[model samples]
Target chain A: METREMTCINCPLGCLLTVTKDNGKVTVTGNTCPRGEDYGIKEMTDPRRTVTSTVRVKNGSAVKVPVKTKTDIPKDKIFEVMDVIRKAEVKPPVHIGDIIVDDIAGTGVPLVATKDVE
Target chain B: MYCRETDVVIIGGGPAGLAAALAVKAAGVESVLILERDTQLGGILNQCIHNGFGLHTFKEELTGPEYAARFIKRVLDEKIEYMLETMVVDLKSDRTVVAMNRKEGLFSIKAGAVVLAMGCRERPRGALGIPGFRPAGIFTAGTAQRFVNVEGIMPGSEVVILGSGDIGLIMARRMTLEGAHVKLVAELMPYSGGLKRNIAQCLNDYNIPLKLSHTVVDIKGKERVEGVTIAEVDERLKPIPGTEEFYPCDTLLLSCGLIPENELSGSAGVALSPVTGGAVVDNTLETSIPGVFACGNVLHVHDLVDYVSEEAENAGRGAAEYVKGQKAGIVPEDDTVMEMKAGKGVRYTVPAKIRPATVKKDVLVRFRVDNNYKDVSIGVFYDGRLERSVKKRTVAPGEMEELRIRKEELDKYPEVKEITIGFVE
Candidate 1:
């Protein structure tokens, strides 16, 4: 059995949450919302975070267009995903939601443009 | 000089200006113009490429540009007119705007109402009074953000951030992702001025240490920043002797604070609030000058852009009403005006005055705290009588808190002379 205390990142309230893992069963307490419980469980299991960064743009008004993962990626892969983002480049007239990279860093999460570059 | 007439003239093209223009057009104002000094719309959001914006307004986490595009699309679809690369040189108390552009040498607009949404600027190194030599690697956090995010240029390979402001926190993560080593982030205050999420996601996740109650005492470099000397400060913020620590870094980023860009407001003879560094406004966001309205960071620095949009809408609607009132020749009769005083632990409140007669439904009073408190209750008092009290588990100076007072509630306190907001232990 293991227990961990952490702050909920779901919202600004930042409710303090305690997660206890006993006999492979996880129980979360001190959460004001269900999302907080889910967050606590995820933290104890597999942590994920949405990555936001800029990629170089070619012949666009902006030198770099901002991009983000379609969904949250594993926490341990943040730097690796950033490495892939740092090396990736896109051309002008990129619209929001345009896919920048597919299956980035083997995370099965595609990188999508968050801003239009024209 | 070319002359034009407009029902409403917004003095900026940032989020505040864009939202205000959209609101004015929606309110049936035919002639509305936005003046932007930048070559593009969206202001600083263009450089803030990070996510976590529009969580409240859009109900989804969005990057700055994505959030801005939503509003920019509305402005375009509404056929609102805006001039890029144009700057409003002067704003007069009589609602006259003198503006300049490359194509139009000099132009003047006679406006029925003017909305001052000029926003705010970062406090620079000169304002901090840190003993330092003018160096190339030292930059304001926003300026560094612009350089790195927009221009694709790295400011330095090694960095030391001087404040834990949101911008500084974001930049700490950004610089690290860009392959720069951020040694540490030193904040002068004991409590961080940034949102808690930022501290967790940006610094704690990245393993960067945050030194609270610490400040940079000296900058060591002649041309480019070579390093900085940091020291701990007492409760009074005076640096204690013999606590100096040195970190070797090429760049020093200052995210100390933001100041309301009110030079135009000052020249326009608007009444300014010493505490907020913005304008003294009434419930309708009307400045001392009748039809001139102020919102967004120009009124008070907001922690979220969503609040800025909301506040700008109020200013826009107020301007529209002012224009209508002028055309109808119905000058508002002076009604019951109550001053809002900040009591203990409260810093200052927006809409310094509340005119019950002018408010249609409710008035939202936004304020901040001087220090951090845990498990405290916020008391809203009317003439020494408690009107409402809200219990908060934790409140920090970084986040702006708001309280809504309905017009109906004010009616119950008809003889209310003053409204005071304070902290109850």
Candidate 2:
């Protein structure tokens, strides 16, 4: 049996959550919402996080265009995804929702631009 | 010298100014002009490339630029007039604005109403009063952010941030993502001044240590930042002796705080609230100078730009009403105004005065606390009588809270002389 306490990052409410696992059964308490419970369980099981970053832009009004993962990627792969983003570059006239990287870090999560660059 | 006249003139082109102009146009104001000192429409939002914006206004997470773009698109679509790279030098009590730009050497505009949306400025190291030699590597968190996110320049290899403000917390994660070692973030207050979500995603997830009740004691380096000395602060915020710890770093980023920019407001003879460091206004968001209105950071530092836009819209609408009233040859009747007083644990509230008669709808009184409290109830009193109380799970100084008082409710208390807001234990 093991127990872990963490702050739920689902939203700004930041509910304090305690998760306990016994015999492969998990119990989450101190959460105000279902999203908090889900966050606690996933944080304990396979922690994942959505990555927001900027990639180099070529001939754009901005030197860098902000990008983020379409969905949460595995927590352990954050650095790998960041490394790829750091080395990647995009051309001008990039539109929002444009995929900057496909299958980022083999996580099957695409990195999409958050803002348009012209 | 050139002279022009407009019904309403907005002093900035940032989120606040853009929203104000749009609102004025929507309110049926024909002549509205926005003057922006920056080369672009978006102000500080241009450098704030990180996400987590517009969740309230747009119902979706967005970057600063994305949020500003939404407003810019509307402004362009409406064909609102605006001048980039134009700076207003002076504003008079009569709504006379003296502005300058390269294209227009010097120009003056007389407006029926003016909205001050100059925004706020980051507190620099000089304001912190830390004993230090003039170093080259020191920069405010916002400046560093602009350099990295906008200019694609690396600030330093190792960074030590002072003050756990949102900007500082965001920079800690940003520098780390850019391959820089963030030693730690030191905050003077026992509790962090940043949003809880930022403390989680920006620092906790990254394993960046947040030292509460700690501050930078000294800065070491002559030409560049070689290191910084940090020490724990006592309850009085005085540095404790013999608790100094040194971290070798190339850069020292200060995210101490933000001050509302009100230089023009002062020149316009607007009465400012010492607590908010901004102009004092009534429920209509009109300053002491009747024709001038203020909102956004110029009125108070806001945690979210969404709120800035909302408040700017109110100011815009207020200015439009004032302009229309003036053109109609109608003088505003002096109505009974009630003063709003901040009680225990409450810092200050915007719109320090409330005129129930002029209020078209409910008035939102926004305020902040002096410290963090958990499971507390906020009480609103009308002339020493408890009117309403709201239970909040948690409240902190970093986040601004609001209590809406409906005019319909105020109508019941016609003889109300004062309203007080405070935290109930």
TM-score of chain A of 1: 0.98
Summing lDDT over every window of 10 consecutive residues in candidate 1 chain B, give the lowest-scoring window: B331-340
The docking category that best describes candidate 2 is medium
lDDT of 2 at B141: 97
lDDT of 1 at B257: 91
lDDT of each: 0.91, 0.91
Q: Enumerate residue pairs that collide in model 2.
A: none
Q: How many backbone overlaps does candidate 1 show?
A: 0
Interface RMSD of predicted model 2: 1.7
Q: Tens digit of lDDT per residue, candidate 1, span B1-425?
A: 89999999999989999998988888878789999999888988888888888978988988898989999999999989999999888988888999999999899999999999999999999999999889889999999999988889999999999999999999999999889999999999999988887888889888999999999999999989999999999999999999999999999999999999999899989999999999999998999998999999988998889999999999999899889888899966867889998877999998889998887889999999899888889998888778789998788899898998788878888788899998864
Q: What's the interface RMS deviation of candidate 1?
A: 1.4
For residue B155, what is the lDDT in candidate 2?
A: 89
Report the lDDT tens digits of candidate 1 across residue range A1-118: 9999887776666677889999989999999989899999998999999988889998888889888898999999999999999999998999999999999999999999988888
Query: What is candidate 2's local distance difference test score?
Result: 0.91
